[model samples]
Target chain A: MAGVKALVALSFSGAIGLTFLMLGCALEDYGVYWPLFVLLFHAISPLPHFIAKRVTYDSDAASSACRELAYFFTTGIVVSAFGFPVILARVAVIKWGACGLVLAGNAVIFLTIQGFFLVFGRGDDFSWEQW
Target chain B: MAGFLDNFRWPECECIDWSERRNAVASVVAGILFFTGWWIMIDAAVVYPKPEQLNHTFHTCGVFSTLAFFMINAVSNAQVRGDSYETGCLGRTGARVWLFIGFMLMFGSLIASMWILFGAYVTQNTDVYPGLAVFFQNALIFFSTLIYKFGRTEELWT
Candidate 1:
């Protein structure tokens, strides 16, 4: 019962995140879809970790240069995602309201992503081929 | 392989294992550097006067620095620390030479940034905000790369 509750909660949060992202881009006051570029960022942010996890099997040690490099890349991507909207706002390409909305969405989305990782990470190994 | 993992060094301590904390801080620093780069680059891109040539110069130099930063950290600490451990095509001195080249590229980026700051931003009597941003961004990248080098966990060759 609790497991189902958790899944439901996670799904709800994910929906909220997507709603925030869409609203930022589609709101009549903001009226700019450029903030949607951050969706690309969402796709990319987790990729380095996935690749690093795949390539390096030793779960005990996190000190591998290859793994660290992957972490570095991931951090870079995350940081860029945060900054992109501000730049758009600064340039007048997107309104300040849209930028703030996108930032909020970014926070929510990233949190959801991390939460999903923590919740499902264990089972992922068993279902590796499915992924 | 075992010997390579042995080369991952810690800053000799007696009481606490600072590894995790160190890694966390370094990751944050790298993120900060990445933010700095993005902010500066976009600022250059958006500025009204749009000093096109100067913008290109700063960007080219910034790209060089970032590439060098990646090059330096991508090489393993095992290859960097010990002379006897090299088994690659560059011979015993190969690792050392590569490290030197990486450092030189990083420094070259710094110098190029300064050159542009003085030539394009300062002499022209324009606002210093953009030039300063680019310079600090480059510097932050240098520091971020350096920190990333030191932040790693204990590994075993086996």
Candidate 2:
């Protein structure tokens, strides 16, 4: 029962975050959807972690270079996601209000994705998805 | 504030491996370094030049040196581990030689940037940011590359 509630809440929060992103683009005065480019960032954010998980299983080794490289790339991707909206606003391609909205959405969406990974990647019997 | 911070204790984090954190940080630093170099050069391209400003040659050459640094560091440390090998021409010793040439280029670029920085600003008495960009770009890329190369060594040891 609790798991079902958590799933619903997560999905609802995700929807709200996406709504904010769409609102930033579709609002009448700030109708320029160039800020939507951050969606590509959102799509790519989990990719490094996914690739790194495949590169190495949790062995006894203290360090894995491939996993470290993926983590490094993921950090850069996260930085770029935050930087993109600010850059767009700085260059006057997007309004300050829209930039703020998009950044807020990015944070929320990223957090949700992290939560998804945490819940799913937790190595236990109650897997988040059916195998 | 202490109590508030304590409320967010992350004890579970101790279970995770953090040995590679330095390498990861160095890699990100390299990424930032590369980004900054590209940005500075782009800034030079976009910004208007002053009367006595140094032209595009500084940027054009600086990027090549940075490229050399990148290639040098991209090589596996294991490939250049030892100075002796009974094998073919391009064995460990050959890798070392290649590493040597890469370092020379990297340092040469740094020295050249320093010269350009001094020449453009100190000698000519110019104040424009574009004129100064190439020097800073080269310096940043050099430092970042050093951090990356050394970080790779740490990975190899571990």
Candidate 3:
């Protein structure tokens, strides 16, 4: 049941994510920033599932690989969700300062995650060799 | 040997009979209809400028598609839950909330698309009453939700 629920949630979320990407592309002429932000948000939103999968799956090596993937996705999603909206709102409201702050905050989070991964030696398993 | 191993190594899980089949069919149909509706909206938005033409066509298609998808999913979810009324999987408060949110988002997108179409129409045609386009879009969303809530469950149960 949980697996079914997860699959459904992932599919529905993918649809929404696709729509966001399409809309961003369609409206890109208005500004590059909005499209960029939307893309970033979509890129990161699948992190939770990756994390959950890694944490739940058996085998330490597989778990570690999944954890790395999870961290990458989680950071991406959290930063983009928190940052992109504020950037959009800022652009909408014409507040460059707010947008800058949001961008900096996103950068901080991204760097922190990278630093953690590096320090912990959590290597990603997204190599062609695995295939 | 490979075929035998493939068959024998498979894991077993709990299985429901008819309900699982029904759910699978409904999900596929709903997904197709939803994507088709999206394609129609995108096509209309890119080409047509007249609100009346856009409203008439898009609303008809959008409303039908939205209702169809919602009904199918609702029925599928219900079947998955079965007659276990005491457990209330379908009626769970969180599920209901998420369902409502999904409906609202879909409806909201329809309305917004209609509004853009109306704006285009007002720019192109003087004969079309400007307010009518907006009214039609909003009304379609409202009516679709009503039909969805009150419509026969059997229409989607197959």
- Per-model lDDT: 0.75, 0.72, 0.45
* Regions of model 1 farther than 4 Å from truth: A122-124, A127-131, B1-18, B83-86, B153-158
Clashing pairs for model 3 are: none
User: If you assessed candidate 3 against the hidden native complex, which CAPRI class would it receive?
Assistant: incorrect
By DockQ, rank the candidates, best first.
1, 2, 3
Count backbone overlaps in model 2: 0
lDDT of 1 by residue, A12-40 (tens): 98789889989889998988998889889
lDDT of 3 by residue, A1-131 (tens): 54345445545544554544444434434333443454455445555655555566554332232333343345435544554545354435424444444444444444444443343323356522332
lDDT of 3 by residue, B12-118 (tens): 55574543234233323333333333433443443445655544454553554355435433532453335436555445554556566656665665666566456
Candidate 2 stretches greater than 4 Å from native: A1-13, A122-126, B1-20, B36-62, B83-88, B114-127, B132-136, B152-158
Which of the two candidates, 1 or 3, achieves a greater lDDT against the reference?
Answer: 1
- B31-95 in candidate 2: lDDT tens per residue? 67755665666556555444346575667657777677757876667677753345576787677
Which segments of model 3 are wrong by more than 4 Å? A1-41, A44-131, B1-33, B77-82, B85-158
Better of 2 and 3 by DockQ: 2
lDDT score of residue B76 within candidate 1: 67
Top lDDT: which candidate number?
1
Best by DockQ: 1
* DockQ scores for all predicted structures: 0.41, 0.17, 0.06
